[model samples]
Target: MRTQFGSPIDYFLELGADTIHMNELLGKPLHMKYVGQQCLNCGKDRKIYRMGHCYNCFYELPQTADWVIRPELSKAHLDIEDRDLAYEKDVQLQPHIVYLALSSDVKVGVTRKTQVPTRWIDQGANSALEIVEAPNRYLAGIAEVALKQFVADKTNWRQMLKNEVAQEDLFEFRAKLSQHIPEEVRPYFLSEKSDKWDLDFPVQKYPAKIKSLNLTKTPEFSEKLAGIKGQYLIFEDDTVFNVRGNEGTVVEIFIS
Candidate 1:
């Protein structure tokens, strides 16, 4: 006997279950022979048409806006290693954050650590206009701000996550994404931007400085060392050093 989607074989494998018997159907071990499709995000060979999504691609997709509200439940399907894998597939480890902002009927987000769905689930995101998972934190932040600025009043953001919006509404939101992203970073998303030029990225530089200095034994230095109990470090690197007390006074310094 066949159900609406046919036999239960595929669902069993997708869930990684050894034996799956639909309670509504006659009990028997099942297997699914599914047709494949090209993955939209990674272009991987997949049986997405019948599977709904390839497991690899599904795990790689950015978490929805609703993740922040129910992180544990939302991430329940994730195994420990899978979380790390997601990050490896879609993002890199760096100082970055992603936000799923709702503007009327749409939501938009970006993150440096977008692989961690729990981050958004903890942020109370209701839904998103677009989830921009990128390598750099700055780009993600700017993308979110762009969407917020352009689609502020046109869409109902809440309905988008709840599945209340129709397909036409999503298409409209998709079209409007161009008005948000800057031309240079537009390649990160599905749509293109009008202002196509290389953005002048701010350069960060390190300073050469001393973190600590150790001196031969002295009275004041000995007293201060006795009372201190924590991490201390001296860096001759590019970091600025803030010295307190008398500069001429000899003191001991410890660096980690």
Candidate 2:
């Protein structure tokens, strides 16, 4: 699923040669048949290990390095190798941001400067604000580690999908939280008034109870498209399928 920011986020799902405009499908009946599975990384017929990677690719690819989840372990600055030093340096040595995002709750996180709104959107955050910027991922990770003592570092996915969010004054929150940042990383905190972003998703209704779909278990299903939020497709029957979770699954989509 590819997303673009808009009045409501615009979603596109590319099926072979076709790019389906998902926003236009709301309230319409759609059928999907899970044909088979393939590895997203190697493009081979294999069971996806994690997020579309084959088992071999999962352990071999630098993108799946341990540092990806634990940014604090990023050693690119020290020229240490996790998978590939060159690849790690190219990614981990780049500029990164420490931010607070409002999804189910306010959470502290770090991401590459370029990922920006994309990262926030992926987490289904309704709003976000950058609190600090660092020259590299390592520094941003350190700042995130420090801030985690005061603020949660993880998003409650279930709560986020339920749209359970509380309003917060990010400016004031950042001010209070900034005081907790370790002295070593405090210098990287942004003093300027940071821009706050509010995001809206294209959805006719939000599910009160989420019913997750597994393509591997149910090969074929049809339902009315109710909404799209984050990477999940909400159906009128209250079934929510995560397109990202089924990244390597091959499916045929039909709409009428």
Best model number under TM-score: 2
Q: For candidate 1, which ten residues in a row score worst on lDDT?
A: 222-231
Kindly give the number of clashing pairs for every candidate.
27, 0
lDDT tens digits, residue span 83-154, model 1: 344643333234343333332244454444533433222222223333344445445555665666654423
Report the lDDT tens digits of candidate 2 across residue range 40-79.
Answer: 7899999888978899999999999888988889998998
Whole-structure CA lDDT of model 1:
0.33
Give per-model TM-scores.
Answer: 0.28, 0.96
True-vs-predicted CA distance for residue 229, candidate 1, Å: 44
